[model samples]
Target: MCGKGQLVTDLESGEIACNKCGLVSSDRLQENRAEWRTFDSESNDRSRVGSPTSLAYHDMGLATVIGKANKDSSGRQLDPSMNSRIQRLRTWDFRTKAHSSTHRNLLHAFNELGRLKDKLSLSDAIMEKTAYVYRKAQEKRLVRGRSTSSILAAAIYAACREMQASRTLRDVANATNVKRKAISRSYRILVLELDIKVPLVDPMKCIAKIAN
Candidate 1:
């Protein structure tokens, strides 16, 4: 049946062939099965290299590059992988810097969204919906070429508005670290894009919450 830890002894050879369901190396197995060893000890040398299911939110602008900010001449502040990350961050920074302050803030907001990407487990369909909303908003001049977060905020707000999620603009602003004015402008852009009314939570959403 090949059950777990089922031991079989070779009658002719006198050596035992262990069919243990473990990570132990067959070579490490002593002649006497009584002398047991943990399999993971042998596997300690192996290591995983990359995060396939991960996405990085490059918020650190100039600080992104290897030796650009506070690193040594060799550009070895972080790891070789960080080079690509820094490059991506710088690229985004460059693209968004040309637009209005609100646009810049929106780009920064996208950085935060990048972090939540894997954590929130946003489905590809939902992400596509988010993208669709952004494109629609862009056509209306609500948002365009901004960081994904700002665009996302507007998209979610639009989606929530349609779905009546009851989530407010202030909530989006606080979560995105974007100014209310910036969000408002983008929201207006959103309204213009979709040609539909979105009930914004108003600037009061930015007011300090009372603590008892």
Candidate 2:
């Protein structure tokens, strides 16, 4: 191994290697940086300094909230009339975000998804996939008369299956406090409506997941 101290890190592969020798020093590097992708020059400049937008959020995490501080651009306290107007603006801003029935449904479902994510220690990919599945269900009006929690749980299960993540329906049900039967029913509906082809679960991965 050439120890020329010329090291290169491949973010895609999460590996650190020596440039001269092509020897990988580390293979499991944890990437803690913000997930930023450049679609265009203008967008790249505008989005350089924030958490990446995500589908899990109802607004895709791009919506801004009016600050509660009753101050102006110069940090001066606003007049009573201006303060009152700002307050109204803030209230309407909050209401308009979830004004639609679909928005409200997504708000509730994503709240549950966040909770289950923490409880089950889900990966970001699985969470995004779950959100996508839930959104598709909503778009098809398949969520009518169904419990949001059950549907969200079913989405999580489907995402897990699709990603080969080794999580079971019972596990998702227990995490979401939804009945297994309900999740199963919802899962079937999602698959039928969305035409999602779920992959077969690997028993070895399941055993390893359970053991861990």
Candidate 2 to truth, TM: 0.79
What TM-score would you give candidate 1 relative to the actual structure? 0.34
Candidate 2, residue 172: the lDDT equals 86
Q: How does each model score on TM-score?
A: 0.34, 0.79
Tens-place lDDT per residue, model 2, 1-212, is 59886888643234679999899988744324555556687654433457666789998887898999999999999999999999999999999999999999999999888987778767777788899999999999988888998899999999888878777777888888999999999999999989999877678886876788
lDDT of 2 at 21: 85
Query: How many steric clashes between backbone atoms does each model show?
Result: 5, 0
lDDT of each: 0.50, 0.84
